[model samples]
Target: MRFQLLGPLSIAEGEDAVVLKPSKPSSLLAALLIHPGSVVSTGYLLRALWDEDQPATARAALQSCVLRLRRLFTKYGVTGSLIEAVPGGYRMNADADTLDLVRFRTLVRAADGAADAESELYRLKEALTLWQGPLLANVPSPMLHRDEVPGLTEERLRALERACDIELALGRCRQVLVDVWEAARRHPGRERFSEQLIEALYRTGRQSEALSEYRSVKGRLEEELGIDPGPGLQRLELAILRGDDLGPAAVDQAVPLPGRAPLALAEGPARPALAAAPAPADTPAAALPSAPASVPPVPLPVLPARLPVPPVPSFTGRAAERAAINASLTARDPGAATVVVLSGAPGIGKTALALQTAHDCQEGFPGGVFILAMTRPDGSSVTPAEAMADLPAPGTAAGRILLVLDDVTGADQVRPLLPAAAGGAAVVTSRRGLAGLVATHGGTVHRLSTLEPEESLELLAATLGPARVNAEPAAARELARICGHFPLSLRIAAARLLTRPGLRIDDCVAWLAEDLPARLSLADDPRMSVPHVFGGALHRLEPRWQEAFRRLGDQLGEHEGLLLSSGTLGGSAEAEEALERLADAGLLEEGPPGPYRIHQLLKIYARRHAREWNRSRTATAPH
Candidate 1:
């Protein structure tokens, strides 16, 4: 059976497509196919089906879909099981090569690295040949649909761009005119498409046509963005006007722009729409392969401007830590093809550290894609299948993107989205160690431990400065200990200090140590605490483990609880299994050499909440 998600979600049994019942199931199946071989958790499946408002029997619904999928597989003449039920979710048991999308991505990466033009062209063609239509076509899922449309659209654009690149490499600029012109007509507002068309026009000695195309694009930008044409296109126009031979070397030159982007040939200022071009009397407007004259004049829709994600601003401290991260990244080939797992308790700065590393290594991986997943209402992670469906295919500018999957306790749900080591690297952060998944994929793991005392002090100093922090060294140390040296707590504590400009360090420490429940109330920001960030992860734990977490907060040491909950503690394996679940959610820390502890702030929060519940019950009891 061939399952397609890179385009329309289709399941074909040999030569014929199988009919899928319950269209919702087909959509769900499609979402999984987008990231085939990845584990998709139950919670994510529900969300893809119902989002925030899950049906009463959501689990049953998901199981039904799985059943339908299995039946379809059976019809395709597959033997035993195609889907495997794993710890937290389901895994589609197939190699990457079996899926067309995976095959396409693999080919693209190979093409990007190829030295020969003919080989690169063949690779690109192979990649492009896999796409059938808009992904998840006819599917009625909000997240899946939104992602499917944009994601596949981006991939199609990339394939066209790469094809142009290969053509240019072989000195076939003139030959690209037919494809480029058609692309320009179809996507009139896409500056990249227009830029390539102009370049091809100029290279083929159609100087006037190239200048007219540039002017047309300029008009579109000015009308749309109220800005002028970007540097590369403008410069190309000048060179063409001056009769300068803008050979291969010129194409490689940077496009001058006000921003820092290396490649902005298509990211220039948006222009206003031009009056529709009049069709030549002799030529039909829209030519097609079948009946050239009968092809209708199709109006091109405006390409929405893709705003870039804001760059990470300079952050404070941990130079050595940052260097260590960069070293780990650079350790693997041209760089490591491994998934660097940053596991630690909530608010220990795992996400922050990973982001910083990603920021630092931005230059190395030009075409890298960065993604941050939000937790679902239920205690499961967002599935890799769903996430992959949403991610735009890597663009030329964003090549070899560093894939950072933050909050990755649900490895089963996300492992499919983890790209194989091709032209990119992946970093996954979790509260618990995903050793099994990492080992299975031959990936290297990096554990993000709590901050050191010195590092903690440095964080405070950065926020409050050396003078204020030094004024009360004892208070600083006490504050660090109270916060368990977790980066989130430190930042919050430091932020509070910054607000009260004249507050003493002792006063801040006293506030944190004492009256913290009352002072750091959820009244201000609902998600300002570690507990807030760990919502879904916490809910997913079994009841016994959840209870054990609360009870052990005051008693367990960091490593002790970690080992106990990570299934290493001695007992009937079931008890250890319970602990393992807690460890994965960032609720319990399982450090090296044994021991486990909750995030210091989380411990305090849960204890107080439990105490309040107990108090309320006692007060309301009838005598």
Candidate 2:
């Protein structure tokens, strides 16, 4: 089964479509899409759903989610339980391609070790082809933002490296000059790109231009890091001086340069001794944007300022769920239909599913997927219009375009990012329900949930190794129980096991039970944790609302997952207003109707602080 989590969550078995439930259920499906091939425990799932305040019937509700997913899979002729139950939770039994990040990583890995020059070039091209857009497009989950943001940056760098490699290997150094020039302009502080440009210049017989490029990079490096060029690069410059041909020679190729020792390449062609070829004045360097003469090595200008790097989220499990999501999205709708939302709580894998879905639909969206990540400043999500403004302007004839806007908690923030026409759909992800927005835009809202038991077990097996999983199913189940079926938690636990090869199943279970908080604490990384990211909202809340938040945090599961609602901490009207405020800030997630939960990690952090407040209250109480 090919799972699609790149866009709207969907699963497809060959040509068939898997139907997912709407709104809340769709959110659950997105959560399941994150892990792809691992088990997600029920506790984690419930906490994701309720944001720490699980319902009395959360178990049954989760079961219903599993049933709905299974039925959808069955309708599409999927024989096995795509959403299956395991000892303590569920898993989506599928492959990595169900998630775009996994597929992208796979291609990247392939490109990394590519041998033959032609094959390496081809592999790089293939790897680049997979990037329709940013991973998960617009949807930004803590689980995804933490992992995907870093991955995206790394992938971009990799793409640049491959492009440079191809240009050098193909002896098309002249062609890449303009591109590298632009890249340097865009990323002024990056010395690697500058190095590539210099190498390309050297290869093109422009020794002076190459030296100029080097000087620029050197200046910038000195300005930024207070250092000189590294040895490899200094060696390259020395090689150039010794009349060494800078053509596509491997690093080890022994080539004599003026005063330097002959460097050797493992399999490089011999370079001709010397040619007094004049620098091509009309070359790309000449075409580059001119600067005042005083600006030495202008091409290597220092960056204006450091760009803000958002947190990268890491998601675990949900291979099958992602496949189902992809299958459903790729499946043709009767009419010219578009617009799918992968909605779920933070860290529940909405973005992960969305990414897989987008990847699956790459062939469908020739215009390529445009992504706008919605970030919150303080407590409020950035508006849609603000996000949309950053996207490349759509062409007059927008054909087969997939636009993604992620983490849109408020309607206003989401409204601007949407495409003007309904011809091509925009896939949006959010913690808050967007029923009104969906109706306004003629879009489909799909809720995502956590994994099923079988899916969970499969994940455990994959993470812990099948041999160990098979021997201790009961232990796995108990571990899953403590994990709460959350993909992130499950992966953390599984990763711990993997790292400690000799870790026993029962020992893991015992550790979880004896120090559940500590075990869960280990799962908390500020970069990947939803609560940490969303805590900005708490800082912006009113004092009364903040107090109410603390109470809600302390009494999460026992209080029907109160979210400034239900008057558990305050009056109904006060609760309602607070809930709205929190939702707008992306701090609180809106569930089915009256239900609400904080983002999973946020909830834990919030509760921790809340408990501290409670202790303070006890101390302050009068006898």
Candidate 3:
């Protein structure tokens, strides 16, 4: 007899399949099968049977459910003693031959041990094929579904991702398209799948469809999650647009196989020493004696440090900020490590500036340049411990290292990961002013603002060429003004023009002027969207500050270059504090003495939310 838990709970012997009629027995069976070969405690079984509403006879009721499951199994010709009443609990004795879930795991393990890509691909495909649908879809158990189903589903997805990686690596793009398309469609929120789908589509001679799919993904993400596609998806779109050579190597660089360390930095001409060297190959196996178990294991060799940051080829501004960062990082301070915190509004080019600086100062730090993402791809905070583990081992690099902690939420998140080595430095970028970090770490903070007008124009001219921007000089200036001179918005606007060669600057400016923040988004990249980026900054603030920002925008909408005092918004001291906090969060810019300024694009975003809030308030008001 075979038990299948990959999908619906069922029993099969030869060509016959059996389903448990009663929900209790099915739930009990599912609970046992979830931990096949291991004992599942009675307490857990009872909870699974009757979640939060256990009867006085719950223990006895669980036994009765187990009996019903056994009887059903026997009726279906299942072998004897499959469900054993172990001490304090029940254990379902299932092997690869008896359970599809067990078989799937066994196949995956075999694939992990497979000698070649072809063998691994075969085993992974076989493992994936066993998953018929959602885990235990027919088993009606809220407990099992809540706790166990998600993990089982993730296991299947990881396997599917691996299988697709192998297929792409093997140059079977056409073969991978069918599975990738379905995966991307079903899991639109998963950027990795979208990236793979885009690559597969592009590689299969469907470039336009690939670009369209990116736009669809960007739209869905914006509409559903109020965010943009991650850096990976954005980079993939740019690569496709450039018609770059996206062979197997490019695919690996773009998506990276899940669960592995990202590709290491190039070692240049000089190779660093390894942590441990291998034994001489000429030594015979019989002559070599293994070290005692008490002996410490040899550490693995450390590869060259690699920052996953992409180059900013068209980077144009931040001359002073770049010089300050370079001086801080390169200064020979043997007593303490340097920390330079770059705080700015979302999409104000903190990261771009950091990347450009790191590249420029690469020669100063002989140890290496490394990047630690403080936020996960899903936009959740990565714990400091996990971030530390992702770093190269201490003393692994040859000399002083430079670490870039990207998208940091707070000073505390960065404190533990700061380099302890003398002469080392860290460049931290965040949406909020990390004053606490500076207080503790003794570093300088550079608060980034919008680009200068000439700088913004230079960025546009650099990207779209001087001839294009100079042709319609006034229109170009208007475009920059509409973009609020924000680097990210400017880049998005420039990318749009670069793609559409024939679109006139004045016409583009007119289109953006109608709905500045909403139209500032690029179809291919979410991070470039004016509203999306500003929304993230707004969402991070306290509720009161968020409301204050929205209300302030509503009052100042389309009133360019206008300044509002805190007293004007609200007379209370709490209102003043809220305004100060909003300014710290980069949502509002502080004037010389007391007033606050909101960017034109940011004001548009705020006004929209303010209108929404007003409607919501009206609807919820007493009739």
Candidate 4:
């Protein structure tokens, strides 16, 4: 049986075609063929088929589609169980030789293992023959189509680049002249293609054109990426200028860009496409193999310029915290991969602080200030691998990058994206203190807290005019206290004041001070409410850590709900772990004198939950 995923979706046994009905189920089958031997998640399929607007009966509909696909395969072939259900989703089982994608990759790997240029070139040409047209061309799915197509294209591109390398190795520069030159011109940042083009131009008695190409490439790299050409590129330019004895094989033995990436067998797992490099005109068969003319240059698009998430509109007061982040991340440390973790409770302005700091840090990190918002809309987290892949591939200037990871859920989620060299900096904001990050490296943790009294006032004035705040000095002070000096609450209070023009500061304070619910409610916005904002952080905690949070909510000392001890918890180790977890999560704070404490408003919320736990336990008690 032969299955094709290189272009469209086709299945055949010998010469007989196995026709497939073009419906949703057939589309599902086509999608499965792209990632054969891998588990395709149900959620991924739902998004691929219907995009984000999934129906209520989406799972049932998807299952029915899968069963239909299974029946179709069963009817078509005696091949047992092509598609089967797995724990999380479905997997399509197929031999490597049966799928074109698998066969193409196998051929490329074989080329990489070949001992000589002739063998390598033959294998590469054979691999290129597998691509009939645009991959998955018939599928009407934006999710799978967009996500999977580019990777296949890149793989073909890599094979072309390798083929050119082999042709140059066998001293057949003229054969690939027009094709490789057009490729280098169309695709910048790829020094390998440029190197081949330069060598070919020089060998054909166009030394000036070769030198001109080098200058053009150098200027483009600096202008587009703020990077210098690699050392090998510089050396080539120097050799060309001085008329050094250069050979065609120099292009093949040359180093890749950045001079840091190893000459590995493969570039991670991505498969980038290549522009067709056709044979040059008037070239002798002895110098270059006879091939079709080069395909016209198709401009490869550059990655879009990253526009970072804008800072909060009413951002105010974090002088000390801002300085701390600046000192840790954007300081003049030449080759140190530093990390700074900003830990605090929910709605405490960790994100605001980190963002504001990044805005002021543009000069130091000329490479770029990239932010990856770590939390999802459902209050869950993006997997570490996905987050890592989403980040722009590090460039030559990766050393000067100031990567801001906002609202991180866990340390493991970011481990893959951490700077490999000690030349970059990362600013991580999370409810849980990522102690593992700093403990493993020379990073620091800045435990953020509620704004100081004066800072809180400044925030109010920043939001509402200074004239209004000055007019009601006493009321303004009272309101700041009532809002617990928390940034989110303060902003909400300010938002409310702006919305209701006739409302007074004193009236606002009194209304809020009326009851616990009133005190917590700064505005009608769900994100503004004290409980809702704090609940996001608390909801992520384990049951045991949550209990520990409840127990430590009230005032410290004798009158507190539960004493801080192993006797209250299960054992000494259990109590210690619980305390550490709460402290790390920023639920436990230091009291005025020195015992563990929580925010005044958060304390009330926690006590309520603790009482609920006790009540539920009492109600469900066995007779």
Model 3: per-residue lDDT, tens digit, 580-604? 8877888777643767776666667
lDDT tens digits, residue span 492-558, model 2 = 6765664344578789889866643345534423333334444544655578778767766766763
Worst 10 residues of 3 by lDDT: 269-278
Give Cα-based local distance difference scores for all models. Answer: 0.60, 0.56, 0.74, 0.67
**Which of 1 and 3 is ahead in lDDT?**
3
Query: Judged by lDDT, which candidate is best?
Result: 3
TM-score of each: 0.47, 0.48, 0.55, 0.48
Order the candidates by lDDT, highest first: 3, 4, 1, 2
Tens digit of per-residue lDDT, candidate 4, span 1-623: 77767654556565333323235675687678778789999898888777788899989999999887778667666557778799988898766678878888898888776654455666776787677543554455667767877777889878878777665544455545634865675567678888877766665556898899889988989899889887667766776798754532322222231112332122333211112222354567788633335633333223233333333444667777788777777666676777888888777888888887877775676556767767754476755654554454555343366788888888887677786324677888998878787777658888888899999998887666566788899999988887778888887776666545468888888887776533565433345577776777777889778777666543243245422444444457767677767767777664223345567766666766666677888899997
* lDDT score of residue 94 within candidate 2: 52
Q: Considering TM-score, which of the candidate structures 3 and 4 is the better prediction for this target?
A: 3
Candidate 3: residue 343 lDDT (0-100): 91
The alpha-carbon lDDT assigned to residue 558 of candidate 2 equals: 34
Model 1 misplaced regions, further than 4 Å:
1-321, 331-336, 374-380, 394-398, 521-523, 534-536, 553-573, 591-603, 616-623
lDDT of each residue in 431-529, candidate 1, tens digit only: 777878776766666666677898888777654556567779999998888877877777667656644455777887787677553454233344456
lDDT of 3: 0.74
Query: Quick one: ranking by TM-score, best first?
Result: 3, 4, 2, 1
Error of 2 at 148 (Å): 25
Steric clashes per prediction: 37, 102, 0, 14
Q: Which candidate would rank higher by lDDT, 1 or 4?
A: 4
